[model samples]
Target: MKTALSLCLLTMALGGCGNIAAVKSFNTPYGSPTSGDTARLRVIADGMVRAVPGKDCVDWYSPGAGVIAVPQKGFADRNGESLGMPKGATAMQGDVVSEVLVPAGKPFTLHFLDGGRGSYNSVTNCLGMFYFVPQKGADYEVVVHGYSACGVKLQQLGAEAPVQVTKAEYCSAMANF
Candidate 1:
């Protein structure tokens, strides 16, 4: 009984220890108002991934650590390339920007790579997934933010108050991604 209680208390205490907070959404969406063009995606990466020097950030996605934000469907195509690592060295802090050209006119899932024990999130732990659809002629921004125990949380930000809330929902379809 004592051991169980100790473990519970420890978990509660460490719950807020590590967190990826204040993920700023982009100030402007990319591109102009074009009728038949694909929507541009501005992914602001703000989270924890056990960064290993000299390894492609995508490599860390396996069992250990890495940070990623990409389209939830058709992630890999043409050349079988999936959206994972952003285009630069993994920075332990601050925002890393990466853009993807999404076919406009519909909604899509955004996947965030929330790693294992290394992340240190003790609440709701798992892959952080959410739903978002891009608007034609406008850029869409999403924040990949979370720690291990907290799993992952995707927040869509608006330029002003009453931020338009993009449906941050989950579905069985995620299993297909």
Candidate 2:
């Protein structure tokens, strides 16, 4: 009985060592915006694998409202490309930069450009990945920004408050060359 009591007391004491805070789940309220963050990423894979580094890469996707954006003529494209990496290093044209949605950590594909230049993101002699996360069911204009493979300025993105709630979305805005 004494051992059991001591164990219980010890356990309780350890458990109460710090302030027990409640963790909020990621189930954000519909249309309620969270911290809309951005990142830099190199195109990894695409729908069909090719002889290019960014041929079949996973891409960055922003969600909100009822529209998804990318670096196409307008928005919404199954296959896209991101010059977001070292030239001839890996990234290539025709690589889709609109597959990944709600990228946070690790590595994800994205249409990366510095300011509004048509260049790929480069980390020394290799390609890099960028991640972006916007609010759910909200209207957001995301701009993907980053430095060119040669360490030049490159990024494009925008975020707007949701006018009408919609399902999760993904897109990649084009950066000027």
Candidate 3:
């Protein structure tokens, strides 16, 4: 009986370890646009950010798209320089930015993940989703806010000032693909 109980406890602990997911790079259109019909998107985050890359969200565990690690502002490498952005991309005020190109006039979704705070016993991760339709030849920026909760803000860059884009509610049950 003692040996059976020990084996059962070990199995339960291993099951909990299977919940971790590997990070996958975004595999769609990236880098600068080749033509004049694509838009530039810069994602700013202090933690891990994963994107669905479509109008709808599928299975929560499905690896739909890419992942980016945006370290906190002023984070530097052993060489003491800030993290790099893509070629022809600019960093703002020491912010670590991940730049990508998405087809214009299409909807895109981003999932901001906050790894949470505190030690192993007290940590609680949070997730926030935001989607927006990009206009051709436009520039946009997404800022992720995280702490006890997670949220995101999208802005259309240009004009006299940046115009805020409204956050649309997303439901995975409506996934078309």
Candidate 4:
């Protein structure tokens, strides 16, 4: 379900899918994704955004921490998908959230990012860029967002250790992890 959706045909823009496929965490700050750096493997940010190691969780969604980042470029005609905050298939519970932190038993490693968006012209797909954490109580390991189809996806990257995401889903923009 890793789609760049800028129209497809990328093995990282036509070079490789080589097949190392390893991830423990990443949103950066030393918490995963490295055999010393394997070129980002096309970046879809696995399992709550992975690239883990040990304690490298620096600052996930920082600005004001009320957390919401959806700087759109193409939202696939407003329905394909984008990480804004409005697009409804299942509508995803409520509040549009994702806040996570992992280390106890390791749920695919952990870090966080995700806001919310989708306009549902029947659901297409296009996603990238947008990070938010607006700055409240701080501890925001996630802030989540949702909208996806076919391959199914949802966001909110785990605000701080709350697992169980199947095709990806989010709703909880942050009031306190």
Q: Give one digit per residue, the lDDT tens place, for model 4 in 92-135.
A: 33322222222232222122333223343334323322222222
Q: Tens digits of per-residue lDDT for model 1 on 19-42?
A: 222111111122222345565555
The Cα error of candidate 3 at residue 134, in Å, is: 0.5
- Poorly placed runs, candidate 3 (over 4 Å): 1-19, 23-36, 58-64, 70-95, 118-125, 160-177
> How do these models rank on TM-score, best leading?
3, 1, 4, 2
- On the 0 to 100 scale, the lDDT of residue 112 in model 3 is 65
Worst 10 residues of 3 by lDDT: 74-83
Report the C-alpha lDDT of model 2 over 21-135, residue by residue, as the tens digit: 1111011111112444433222233222111011123222112221122232332233343424323223334323322233232222233222223333334232223233333
TM-score of each: 0.41, 0.20, 0.56, 0.22
Q: What's the true lDDT of residue 19 in model 1?
A: 21
Ranking by lDDT: 3, 1, 2, 4
RMSD of each: 14.0, 18.8, 8.4, 16.0
List candidate 4 stretches off by more than 4 Å: 1-123, 133-177
Weakest ten-residue segment in model 2 by summed lDDT = 21-30
Which one wins on lDDT?
Answer: 3
Model 4 RMSD in angstroms: 16.0
Q: How well is each residue in 2-67 modelled by candidate 3, as lDDT tens digits?
A: 976765565456443232332123222222334546676777665656555445442233333555
